[model samples]
Target: MENPAEVLRRVFGHEGFRGLQAGIVAHVMEGGSGLVLMPTGGGKSLCYQVPALCLPGLAVVVSPLIALMEDQVAALRQQGVAAAALHSDLDEEERFEIRRAMARGELRILYVSPERLVMDGTLDNLARREVSLFAIDEAHCVSQWGHHFRPEYRGLTVLAERFPLVPRLALTATADERTVDDIRRQLVLADAPVFRGGFDRPNIFITAEPRETERAQLRAFIKRASDGRGAGIIYCGSRRKTEDTAAWLKQDGHDAMAFHAGMEASAKREAHHRFARGDAVIMCATIAFGMGIDRPDVRWVAHTDLPKSPESWYQEIGRAGRDGLPAQALLLYGPGDIALGRHRIQESPASDEQKRIERGRLEAIVSIAESATCRRRALLRCFGEDLEEDCGACDACATPPKMWNGTVAAQKMLSAVLRTGQRFGLGHIIDVLRGRMTDKIAQHGHDQLPTFGVGKDLPDHTWRGVARQLVSRGALDVAVENHGELLPTDQARPILKGETQLMLRADTVSKASTPRESSAPERGEDPVFDALRQWRRDEARNQGVPAYVIFQDKTLAEIAYRKPRSLDGLAGVPGVGTSKLDKYGDAVLEVLLEAGA
Candidate 1:
């Protein structure tokens, strides 16, 4: 068997192993079973991929995505490793050819979806041979309690029972404690030695903005994130958002394409190819678009709307900086997104118990948005990881905002909503707060209410603050279809009656990173700062890699703050791998010394 370091170089053009990768590979090579919880780009695939090559017989791998299977197979084949996939998308001839190759002992790695794995003869065929290993990729989807539940994935354990000789390895990029346990139980890997890699990626700077005009905001986000350079992903929550944003970006003269389940397969494949070949700058897409893309130069991943949960957020942002370059994770949460997310679960065909769990997950997402504490800490906590302080890479860490007591303000808002029968939305409620006397008020005959105009002292923007903070804090929920229809939640009951207090963080504005009038102390870790940019030419270029893969502004800021001078020192600088250091270290050092770092 090739040494793990040699395995990396031979297969993927890397010359070394990251912290836990070698350990994981060794465990698998020794025929031990385990679960792996690693962040994206942590070499999770290599953990099993290397062992498969060293093992005696065909390694049967289960993946949730056909695109992922095909991409992996192509990459493997590119390196002269024999791999093939069996999926529904393959034609009869393609399927038969794959079967023939496996039967002839010509295929080394066989990839199949969980659905195909559960098919009658698929396991029997694998069981007939040595079947060295079974790898479950994106294993988090197997649990019914999981957000991305796939019923077919539950049948994955059938192979484990039939082919007990094969070592099983379950891997996922974003799974919390509950999700990890769910994967273990569903896949029947009871005593697997779980290998957990660090969730902290200091190179990736995270920020969030409340989405106002979602379309307009997303448009502006896409433009600014490009920083006049390499490709990025703008993930929309729905197909309409994807098509509309992709079209608008094209009209705005950006080289963009749309990818979604709603599009034709050929179009989807074309878009994926265009993105991989660096022909597209931004691919406007729904959740369906990002599953298996292997491109590593993506500089940014922006969520135009809030995702269903932190796991979803982690997975989406994971796509960026795969080549170990610094990336930006810019998330936009429209106030309306919470209701939509919850209503999605509420409307799902599930048992009441499942609905309750789903609702809790949605509520947890909203807390992530509103929390003034460290955003990364809160997120890591959700996934059973604990970080003591703010992660300087996130918004809360970069710009510390102030908190104001909004307990009185929340009481007043809830009183008004309930006093008025809870039928009207924010617009009407705002009107009553400002003492605006209009025909609509008289038509509804709400003017005579005791709470009418009682909130005249609060400004319109202040009222906006009260509303935004309340929703963030879970005192209220907007109607899913009618986001305008704000309703008090059970949480609001005690607060409205003056039983509880609300202290909301005063919103802070983060300025763009440019030469400020006076230098402010820097916060993030970017080895190259002080020097201004070279040109606004095409991004994702330099040293045979994409531009976004270089150094993001936030990372640059961090580097400017903590000037590291050695390889080990620079290694702590987010995204500065041995490969990156070998390629760009001198240039970065020149910038640092020139800037007096």
Candidate 2:
């Protein structure tokens, strides 16, 4: 059998394995089971794919999404590998052909969803074949503590029971310590080695700001980040917001589309198709749109509202910069978003332990948003990884927020919440603090409270910021069952009793200065690069696949920079495997010559 390196070079075109990939491939090839925790775009697929090619029999892969399965199959086929996917979308003829190929040992890899793999007679049929290994993608779904938990994934544990001798690998891009433990226990891979590729995407520039004129902030972010080039995804919290944001962007002359779970299946497919094909399209969507996407040139991702947990936020932002290119992620949120997040956890049917876990996750994300320190460091801490130094890529590291002694302000805010009987929401409490005689304040007789007008020196927005910071600091909580009232937590006692002081970031609309340019190596203006990109776009269009599937932007950039004069010279460039070299190498040389490369 060919070694993993030979398969990687001849098929995948990559010269060498990335971090931990070689170890993972060798382990699986040696009939050892393991768990892999790698960040998105970290070459996690190569870990399993390389071993599957070196192994003896058909390697079965369990994937969660049809789109993900189809995309991988298509890419693998492009490399002249025998790959097939059995999904619900396929017709009977296609399924029959795939089953025949598997039985005849004509296919090297087969992809199936968890539901289909666990169905009656499915495992029985597979048992008849000489199976090599079982790879479970998106393995975090099996854990109840995961952000994207699906009950179907729990059925996957049977793979170990049925194929005890076959090497098994569970892989995910996002998982905390608790979720990791749960995945191991549920999948019964307790004795397997766990390979953790560190969780840091330095190519992604992270930034979060208080929501101030949401449309304006998003528009400015898009312009600054992408300059109207490449693809972007705007995540909204609600279905209606997706539609409204998409429409608004379209009105502003962007090629925008709305996607949500509420859309018809055909509509969602069409939207996904357009996004995959178009170079400069913008997708306004809820969280439903990201997991299945394999497109690598996404230049930016923006969140109009806060994500429910740190895992969700990390995964969502990770969709950008998948090609190891410079990308930006912007998050716009407010106090209401945090309150709603807390309220949802409180109202969930989960047991107290689960609720506590979720609440901690929510608070962790909130800390990331309001943090005055390195955002990347704080984000990595959630996954139990530590960054020794500040990552210069995040907005916080680029432009640190100004912090001030807010002990007096915190006292006033806590006093207002307490004086209002801890039964009023932010708006009403703000009204009382600002000494505004609103009807609700009059009805509650809050104007008579001693804390009334104590904070009148600060503006409404400042007070709102203070309230948000207080909630984040655990000095206050939102009472969702009581109509979103503000309640003090035990941590509030120190500030209320003058036992401790508080330091808060000075919240303002202009907190973030002009962002510094990304530290990533610049792809300078090379006419050769532009011409090659156009040629690639045309070629991809002719083939009816996403442009990146033909060749990633990073590979194209290298080609343009190198200006390889012959097919052999082009093959020397990364991403030019034997299959691609035999297929499109001459065409690439011709384009380069035409462009005076």
Candidate 3:
């Protein structure tokens, strides 16, 4: 049997394991079960794949989506591995052939959806064979505390019952402490060792702006980040917004496409294929579009609305810069998004305990967005990881926002909420604070209150910003049951009683600002790199696969910079594995020679 390191070098083309991959792979190869908590682009798949190659029998992997299964199978096959996926999209003949291959012990790795794996007789058939291990990808889906929960994942617990001896590896990119604990209990892997890779992705530049002229903000973000050279994804909160945003971007001369669950299957596939192939297309999509994507050179990800939680936000933004290159993440949100999020939690069918968990999650993300300190630190704190110092990559650390003493503003806002009996939303409270003579304020007799016009000096937008900051700081809460009323929390008592000082970001009260340039080192334009990318694009189109599957931009850039003249020199590049060097060595050298390398 080949060791994991040899398999890693000869098969996957890398020299060694990253972070906890080596230990995780060794543990699995030794017939031990465990859970893996690694960030996206951390090579989680390689942990299971390398072990499967070293093991004796077929390695069964439980994946969530058909697209994920197919992409992994395609990439593995390109590396000369006998991998196959059993999915509904495959034809009957393809399924039959895969079954035959499995029976004959020809396939080293097999990927199947959790739903398909738990089907009648599927586990029985697998048990009759020599199964090596069970790998559960996107393991967070099994936990109700997770952002994207699927009921089908609960059935996966039976894998331990049926294949008790086979090693099980549960993997996910996003999960808090609660979600992680829940995943362990739900998957029946409570005793399994947990390996947690750092949740920080320093390559991703994070920024958030209050939604002021959202369309214009989005356009400016795309232009600055992509420069018509890189791909991007804009996540919207609704299906209609995806379509509208896509159309608007296209009108502005961007290569944009809309993708949503509402689209037909064929349409979705085509959109996915285009996104996978095109170098500079922007995908305007709901949250449904990003999970299974394997594109490596995506330069940016933007959110037109607030994500449900910090976990979801991290997962979505982590999709960019998968190749460890510099990428940007811009989030645009407003009070409306916050209210809607709270309202959704209030209206959910979940029990009180679950609702409380979700509400905390919502508030956590809101605080991250409105935070005046290091954004990366706050985000990592959600997953129970602490960044000792500030990450200089986020917008907060890049260009520090001016902060002011908002204690007076907070007191005035809280006083109005209390005087109004906390029954009205922000708009009504703002009216009473600004001393606006509205019919509702007049009817409620708020004009008679001492705190009614105490905040009259501040503008409406300024008061709104103060209210949002107050909510984010846990000094106030939105009562969705009372039609989005503003209510003071226990923490508010100190501010209202002049016992606590409140500092707020000054820019939140001012006009929205543009995202700053990423602090990551910029790559200068190289003729060799450009020529190599063109050749790669053409070759990938000829082979009908994603360009990254052929040769990642990082590899091509390295080759262009190093100017590898011979096949041996080309083989020295990091991503140039034996299979790729053998297959494309001559062609790559030819391109280099033509470009005067």
Candidate 4:
């Protein structure tokens, strides 16, 4: 068997391992199992892919989605490795071919969906051959409480029962402490060594704005973020919102498409194909779209509504800058989102324990949105990680927002809710506070209430911010059966009594500051880098593959910056393996030399 490092450089074209990758690979190579929690684009695949190549038998990789399996197998095949994915999408002949290859030990790695792998006789076939190991990707799916729970993933424990000697590796891009523990229990990986990689993605600039005009803010953000030169994803909360937003973008002359589980399979497939194959296209989608996407060059991710939890938000935003380039993540939320989210949770039939856990998760995300501290710091804290210093890339650290003590405002809002018998929504409460003598106020009798019009000096947005912050801070609650009417919680008693002070971001109408333009000079400014990218794209198209499959943008940028003059020099750069050096080195050198000339 080949060494892991040798396989990494020769096949994947990376010079060495990153973070816990080396240690994890060694453990697995010694027939040990482990659970790996790494950030998106943090090279999680190498933990398994390298070990699969180094091991003896057919490495069975349990993947959740067919698209993810297909993409991974495609990239591995490009490196001259014998890899194949078995899924429902394949024809009988293709399945037979793959089966024959596995039987003959011609395949190094075989990707199978969890459902298929757990089917009757699947383990029998693998047992006939030298089954090297089992790798479970998206292992967090086993956690029933996780954001993207897959019941099928829980059945993956069978791999350990049947193939007792085969090492198992479970990998995920996002998981909190609870999800991690649940994964261990469900996937039977408790005995496996756990490797927790850093959750930080400094390459992605995080910013969120309180919704003013949702569409207008999104349009401006798109203009500022990608400038129509890169690809991106815009996440909408509902299926209808995704379709409408996509249609709106198309009308604005953007090359955009809508994708959601609600769409027909063929239509969703077409949309996925277009975004994967083309550059600078915007995909307006629900949360259904990104989990299986392996496209590495996506430049930005935007959310038109609140993500359910900090974990989900971080994973969604982590999709950007997968190629290690600068990227942006922008979220726009309003009080309605908070209300809607609470209503959804309250109306659900989930167990009380699950609901309580989910509510805590939601509150954490709300805190991140309303935070005056570093966005990265708040986000990382939710996952049990901490940054010693603020990340200068996020909106808060870039331009500190002004904060004001909202203790008095909190008391007024809570008093209005209480005095109104806690039967009104924010709008009615705001109307009461602004002293609007509407028919409803008159009918409720006597604008003589002590709290009415007390908030007249505050703008509508300011009041909205205060109310949402109260809900986020547990001082206020939304009554589910009452159409999300505001109600004070026990926590509100302290704040109302002046024992607990509330501090909130003051400029409610002001948006989060846009991240500074990347200080590193644009790659396009270097002709050789541009030429190399063009060459990679052409090569990728000719081979019918994604450009990153040929060489990552990071690798190409390094090549351009180093301007290697010979094949030997090119081989010395990261991502230039012996095979790639032999296949494309001359072509790359010619492009670089011609650009220099």
Which candidate number has the best lDDT?
2
What C-alpha root-mean-square deviation, in Å, does candidate 3 show against the real structure?
3.3
What digit string (tens of lDDT, one per residue) describes model 3 on residues 40-157?
A: 9899999899999999999999987777787788788778889999988889899899999989999999999988899877787798899999999999999988878889999998
Model 2 deviation from native, Cα RMSD in Å: 2.4
Q: How do the predictions measure up, each by TM-score?
A: 0.81, 0.94, 0.90, 0.92
Candidate 2 colliding pairs: none
Estimate the lDDT of model 2. 0.88
Q: How far is 201's C-alpha from truth in model 2 (Å)?
A: 0.8
lDDT of 2 by residue, 30-103 (tens): 88999999999999999888988998889999998887787788788778889999888889898889889888
The lDDT for every candidate, in the order shown, is 0.73, 0.88, 0.87, 0.85
Which number leads on TM-score?
A: 2
Clashes, model 3: 0
Rank by lDDT (best first): 2, 3, 4, 1
Which runs in model 2 stand beyond 4 Å of their true positions?
Answer: 414-457, 478-493, 513-519
lDDT of 1 by residue, 211-291 (tens): 655567566556555554347998988889888888888898888777888888878777776676563378889988766
What is the Cα-based lDDT of residue 237 in candidate 2? 94
TM-score of 1: 0.81
lDDT for model 1 comes to: 0.73
The total of clashing pairs for model 2 equals: 0
